[model samples]
Target: MCGIVGAVARRDIVPVLVEGLKRLEYRGYDSAGVAVLNGDIKRVRRVGRVAEMEAGVRAENLQGEIGIGHTRWATHGGVTEPNAHPHVSQGLIAVVHNGIIENHEEKRQYLRQLGYQFDSQTDTEVIAHLVHHYYLQNGDLFLAVQQVASELTGAYAIAVMAKDQPGVLACARMGCPLVVGLGEGEQFIASDISAILSVTRRFQFLEDGDVAEVRHDKIHIVDRNRQPVERKLHVSDLSLTSLELGSYSHFMQKEIHEQPKALADTIEPILEEGFSPALFGAAAAEVLPKVEGVLILACGTSYYAGMVARHWIESIAKLPCQIEIASEYRYSETFAKPNWLVVTISQSGETLDTMEALKFAFSLGHDKSLSICNVRESALPRASNLVFYTRAGAEIGVASTKAFTTQLVALFALAATLAKLKGQLSVDQEKQHLDALRLIPGSVQHALNLEPQIKLWAERFYSKHHALFLGRVLHYPIALEGALKLKEISYIHAEAYPAGELKHGPLALVDQDMPIVVIAPNDALLEKLKSNMQEVRARGGELFVFTDLDSHFTESEGVNVIRTPRHAGVLSPIVHAIPVQLLAYHTALQRGTDVDKPRNLAKSVTVE
Candidate 1:
């Protein structure tokens, strides 16, 4: 969860580098630095926000038309000036890196034996020293970087500049994101499209193990074997205005309010015609008929999205479905059947753990995998045999809001398609589900209307030290997502359990000081969930419930209720998540915490 920006332009690039880093700030970073070659390499690193780095650049009058910059989330070393990037090697080469070098210690010792000293306790500095080690022997910047990349182990996206290689930047990526921007008499490189969008949208996404050389007027890309590679330049249609905070106080608030539209976009394609298995891809029509079971792989919020889909798949499609946390799946000797349909869900499509799990699953004979992701051309989407683009747009907030709901929309569509293929749904039933899907946007708007009530309920959370969220069956994942949001932004210790599981252990932690959040959709399990809520109240636990309009529950002493529009039937999870998101947003706002870029977190987990 770091950012890298490099550019070679005919004019002063300091301002461009600063603004680029500003855009990448959403990715989350604790320090920022830049290096430029003006006859010699000059660099400035600060152990704070990009604004501080900008001030440092201006005060020091750091100017160069060619430079590389980084915004780092500390990994190998502590967050300090010396640990910041653009770390110079022998005062001749500067390198900025993202991701971890798993074998840096061995290389560090090897370099020390060769009379090379390290200034910062960083794996990145090893890359710099290793580059210098190779450059001294080969006298070629590109070959030196290639040699260093060959020697290093683990994930990294690095941009390098040498005094001898003025007006040029060499970059390489493995298990991290890197893109090259095309412009007139200039070229750019960045970790993501947002960083270089203001400069140029025409860009090429660098695949893992690809090395790039960006010059003022041209750019070259090569594979790990040093063979020339051709990658198409894509002109992104994302509006710069979409990245801005409009009337909303924070990006998290803005994103929370954008769920209606995001869900609408996700369902639009399936709604155009009735939902069908063929909507997934051309092979889905054939694959759906033979599919014996379902397997879902994902991490973080996307993993919770997969959990909600497990209920949808088993109950609706009547398929035996299993879910795995991506990080653990890779290390497990899990069984993967060839007939099972494996699905991977991610917002960025570059989640390292999920990507690795997908690869590992494929290696185990589960090659028929699909990716439900937001970003096009990202690693997960590109690697999948079939892809369902979520169309959630760019989710800038570190705490996901719109992305989670939109992923559920996609998953529900997949469920309906599978159910139809399995003869579990008739034509009439399919039409009804489509109509319900069509009404989701309106239902989400109604959920947003309850924010004022949710905000009022959130006032009690300003002093809360702990929270417990309760839901039953399908809604349990929503409960988990709500608890995660509370802990993420509000910094309150929170936990979620299936309402039935409370008495087993978590109920002991409940007291008047603990707030219990109940996602009480008016399903068959409502009565059971209500009984569980009563147990919390019996222990003097405060209750905040988000329920349907016709639910039997009501507001009273020690109980708060925010009524939603109506029960969404099978699509209730998508509707119920809105209030949960708003609850977290307003609680964070009330607590005066960073609502968008929560501390110690990044928007995209590009590294393990």
Candidate 2:
């Protein structure tokens, strides 16, 4: 994923564009650039972070009332300055874009035949050339952009500014996100809300095929057919504090600690008096009871959240649940039955694989779609028939912490709501689950208090080249998440398996140097998990156990135990996610790796 920010203001917009790029830097950071339309089209780009690009712009003294800026994630070419955004066309048009242009090679060849020369190996470069070609034909920037949108094949959110058109900009969106920010005497456009939040809170989200004409004092929006369209402008609810780390060392650590408030916010509606399935939606009471099964599509940490929900839905609601990696689900021949509910989970809610997977499921006769997401206005939530918004706020870290836990809270609530709708949960059982849900925030605080002792475990992990994570039943996904966190940030080679499967294959990798982390929650499988721990000990593998206070386990030679304040029954996964996140954060700190932005990985995977 890349970030795009543009503004048409009465004053010099270079500083505003640079500041907006800084807020959007978490989207991508490999390269950044900007285009300013003053007397002539001035372009400045660099092969590093946005800060480098800002420095270059200041050194060059580029000034304009209208400008567009971008921070790239390097999809089509190497992270070179020439491959950065704001690609210029014939000294007239400048373009900044997000998302892929699938047929760019064909278009590039055609443009080359028309005697257009190319400079960079980016799919986005063709956009500027194509728009310039159309502008030469019609002499209208808005019409030129509309014509070019018809020829582009893949996902794109593009902003085009012309040197001749001094105070004007045109933007179009197909599959990626673009929004128009309304101000008193200025107009702004960005790929994310955080970029333009300071400039304007009132914004209109452009739809799939909408084109927007933006100038210094006004913005006009229209659909593909050239008919004017009206869109509602909503005020944004995000504050700048959500984007800043108050006193934490890294964003991952801050997000891990933010889970309590996030969880409480997510479950607040369900905890209120007269809770019902209608709380989710008006049609939820009707649709949920008739649903036959559930098909969940997600990627990365979101997929693991689905895995945890599978246990809850099957045990509580008695529903057959299946989880699919969103990337693979579209290509697979898996058919969905009619009336089968489709659930999608994402932190950004704009993940392309998950969005495509949702479309594929709908194409196969599945009508019901629900999105569990943190973003209220992202594509995934908008495409779904029902939406459950998670108030996790903005997670800036590449490694997910608060978003994943809040997703679990949402999914668990969905399971409980479905159970109540299906008549599977009695009133007392419902009350018990609600009571446990209410305790999660305080229980998470208790788990976070184990940070000092967990630091000792982090010391053990510093030298571990390889690690094995083991869990049983409801906790296996937590084990997988733990391993994922360690590898994502610490660069450690980690693998997770069900505890019973250790003797089958993973046990052979056990040795004195390897630390075997076990998610030994005091549940029905606690004794069985303990026996598996003994197997690791017999093979000379060091044991790190995360358990509750009343557990019978004790620390011994080669084994270390960390206990929380209480044992969580049905809500154990939400509670257990904390220590593993902390473990990963501290381990990454010990390894001297970047905890916020891991190398070669972007926070949002917008491209395939």
Top candidate (lDDT): 2
Candidate models: Cα lDDT each? 0.89, 0.90
Task: Compose the digit string of candidate 2's lDDT tens values, residues 1-608.
Answer: 88999999999989889989988888888999999977888999998888899899989999988999999988899999889999999999999999999999999999999999999999998999999999999888999999999899989999999888887899999888899999989999999889988888999999889999998788888897878998788899899888888998888888898888998998888788333766667677777878878899999999999999999999999988999999999999878777679999999988989998999998888999899988878889889888888989998899999899889988888888778778888999989998998999999999999999899889879888888899998899999999999999999999999999998988999999889999988888999889999999999999999999888889999989999767889899999989998898899899999888787887777777
lDDT per residue for candidate 1 within 238-263, as digits (tens), equals 88988888898888888888888888
Q: Estimate each model's TM-score.
A: 0.98, 0.98
| Candidate 2, position 179, lDDT | 90
Q: Candidate 1: where is the Cα deviation over 4 Å?
A: none
Each prediction's number of clashing residue pairs: 0, 0
Angstrom error of the Cα, residue 127, model 1: value is 0.3
Model 2 CA deviation exceeding 4 Å by range: 273-275
